[model samples]
Target chain A: METFQHSFPSRPLAWPADRSWALAGVVGSGNLEVLIEPNPAAPDAVAYDLQTSIPGYADSWKAALADFAAHYAVGGTRITLHDQGAAPVVITMRLRQALDLLTPAQP
Target chain B: MSRVPYHELKARERLAAIVDPGSFAEILPPPARVMSPYLPKLGIPVAFDDGLAIGRATIDGKPIYLAAQTGQFVGGSVGEVHSAKLVGLLKAAARDRLPCVLLIESGGVRLHEGSSGEIGIAEAIRAVFACRAAGAPVIAVIGSDIGAYGGMGILSACCDFRVMTEHGRLGISGPIVIEKWMGKAAYDSADRALVWKTSGGKTRYLLGDANALVNDDTAAVRAGIARLLGPASPVTLAAIEARQAELAARLEQFAAVTSPEAIWQARGVTDPAAATLDDAETFVASLAPAAP
Candidate 1:
């Protein structure tokens, strides 16, 4: 098992007032889950705390998350990931799904 | 996928088939990422919903809380998080006065997590009774091949009603465990017929352990549940005494019997072979109801 923490600078979040947190995916074989919750203290940073069953992938995880943080307005949220050897595509998809569920859609 | 047998469907698929269209709302859906913290310690894969998918849904426009265990993951075992989810759901059902349905396909507690799983199942059982006391029906659906074993079998017994299919087996000890302890000659696990006769849905129903036996179809299982949705069986002193006497009488009546066929014959099943081969409807119709 491997555990790490990393934070990335990103645009501030446009969180919905009705919701504070959202979760996505399940941690199973070759699958992972992403949980995103509001963090008022870190208004301009997205914190990533991850624990994976498969070790030695910290560099890959950091790269993937950095890319997600750069692309999305996920600032002011704490994202925690529990991974079980999910592919890069699955990880990104779960992150996007969690974020989509967190933010309200435009009418 | 709609043609797929209920016993073959996955946890999510089962939920989709049983609940009303577009009415299912997961309480802590997969997105919640509530993975088990202990699995990683043992170098095992963790499931986001801890191998149990629980949510709220309407059955025939009536509200209910539903839980389905994923047999594909970890043999649908119950761990700390999984059992806690069950307990929470049952308690919520009691508080809300809603029926709770458990689609059980587990081999009971997760041995890896040890005592936590056991304690969680115990807590869930207490919650089951709590729901009963609050006039909320708790239904156990055991239609999968994995069936319910270990503490889960006891938990199923505690529910207000049990809906089982021919593929479902409910017992404390599985055939393999019993064979290991009692030796091959005493109990041959390889003999599927004898094994099923001992603990399968047909045997359980005949023994009065399972309330209803349905076919291996989602529609049949759903219908069985629908029939029992009106009101929960109240747990009164008279009911408890009657149940105790019934169980004791069952033990004494079958004490000298070595084969399931003997019990079937004693129960007025003229041809045990025909009874075993018949489908759920025919099998149920052929049997004599238990004496009051």
Candidate 2:
């Protein structure tokens, strides 16, 4: 029922120098999934697009995405989030969690 | 103070109370804080484990993997994190050769998350069968009022056994939905007695869908759990065929009957009112073995 948009800055991801797209999640109630794909159009910025059912927390979402982009080196990827009323805290956590799973920090 | 009684215990508390004391070791604790990726735009409150509590525990010293749905949080619906936790837990049970006990209280897939919960439930079903194929037991407990509906109901049906209480209910679509679909003349949701007769524990027991019917009391539930802990029901092809044949016959027999009470009478349950009032023990003893 609500929609929001934001973009974050980050260094380009370090893949095997090959893969183009990586997606995670399906559309469901009370939850939304994210799909991160490689977008060469804007290598310096990771564009974020979000659509949700439970509206009125755009600022919180922006903060979460902004923080995630700043922390992760996921520049060339465009992250699209589809959510259905998940909490702001959960959104931030899941975005970070997904990124962590995709790109683990070196030991 | 806790607003609810035994039923009020969150998923974890329920698990702890039923399982052997101190035997529950949570797989991924809240400190891990695994949550749903969706919902913030909608402004929903997120639980620590995304509303599902999964862990390893023992009941009557029988090792089992326990997963309980938190109905309070989003109707205990499954989202990505919740579903993944469940899938992972089932996989763990399959790998460990442990029986899996699901304290089902979900309203099916979480609609807020969309198709992710739906697909996750399907995956969980496959996982359940995998465990069954591996000789691991998967027991579904429908003690909560939510019982299981939607995709979760089908998953519960696929389970080896279902244990329920008079307060418990099970069906693919809830009475409200059915009533809406059928209209008040066809099905009345507010008719509590009618609803119970249609899908309540006693009805399910008479129909043979519910393996055991216990009282609302926790002690009775615990006893029922202890009784069924020894064996996991595996759904082999032969068993499925047999069940299909049997269910087909029952449907044929009762499909034409508009009154649930009539079905009860034909099932050899004399005085439907008397039978409904009987406690779990009496109810089980009073009934004749299901007609072939």
Candidate 3:
């Protein structure tokens, strides 16, 4: 088991006032889950906390999360993930899904 | 016509088949991250839903609470988080006055998590009775090949109704465990026929243990659940007394019987072999009415 915590600088998030949290994915074999919730303390940073069954992939995880933070305006949110050897592509997809669920639909 | 086997369907697929189209809504779906923390410590992968999926759905437009255990994930064992979800769901059913259905397919407690799983199951059992007390029917659907064993088998018995298929086997101890303790001559684990006869749906139904025995099909299982969704059996003192007497009579009447065939014969199954081969409908039709 491996655990890591990192925070990425990001623009302020335009979160909906009604929704507090959102989640995506299932942590099964070759799968992972991402949970996104608001963290008012870190309004200008996106906090990423992860626990993975397969170790030695911290570099890959950091890269993926950095890319997500750079692309998405997920500031003032805490993102936690439980991974089970999911590939890099799946990790990105789950992150995007969680973000999509967190963000309110456009009119 | 060949169809997809019920046991082969995934947890989500089973939910889709058992409930009304597009009515199923998950409570704490996979994304909730309410998973077991013990599995990763033991180098085992943790499932997002902790191997149990609980949600609200409707059957025939009537609301109900439902849960499905994923047998492929950790053999569908109940760990701390898994059993907590079950307890919470049943409690919710009691609070909402809704029927609760469990699509059970577990080998019982998760060995990796040890005592936590056992305690969790005990807590879940208490919640089962709580639902019954609230007049909410708690149903166990044991149709998967994995069946329910160990604490889960006992838990299933505590429910108001049990719906089983021939593929399901319910017992405290599995055949392999019994064989290891009693040697080959006493009980052969490899003998699938003997194993099924000992704890299969047919024997349990004949013994009045299982409430309904249906075919190994999703529609059949859904129908079985639908028939039981009306009202729960009231758990009164008189009802308990009658159940106690019936159980005592069953024990006394079958005390000396060693073979399942003897029980089958006593239940008016003239040809046990033929009855075993019959489908659910034909088998139910062939049974003689119970003596009042």
The predictions' CA RMSDs to the true structure, in order, are 5.4, 10.6, 5.6
| Candidate 2 C-alpha lDDT tens digits along B1-292 | 2222335565777787888888998887654658787866456545557878799988888889989887766777888899999999999999998888898888899888888988999999999998888888888888777778888889999888888887778899989999889899999999988988998888888888988887776667767777777667766689889899999999899888999899889887888888878876787777747531
Stretch of 10 with least lDDT, candidate 2 chain B: B1-10
State which candidate, 1 or 2, has the greater TM-score: 1
Clashing pairs in 1: A23-B31, A23-B32, A24-B31, A27-B46, A27-B48
Ranking by DockQ: 3, 1, 2
Local lDDT at B177 for model 2? 96
For candidate 3, what is the DockQ?
A: 0.26
DockQ winner between candidates 2 and 3: 3
Best by DockQ: 3
lDDT of each: 0.87, 0.77, 0.87
Tell how far residue B92 is off in model 3, in angstroms: 0.9
lDDT of 3 by residue, A12-96 (tens): 6765524677767666678887878888898889999898889898898888899989888888899988788889999999988
On residues B1-292, what C-alpha lDDT tens digit does candidate 3 reach at each position? 4555677777877888989998889988865778888887787767678889899999999999999998767778999999999999999999999999999988999988989999999999999999999999999999887899988999999999999988888999988999999999989989898888889988888888889988888888899899999889888999899999999999999999888889888987889998889977678778847622
lDDT tens per residue, model 1, B198-273: 8999888888888899988888888899999989999999999999999999999999989889987877678999
C-alpha lDDT of residue B156 in model 2: 90
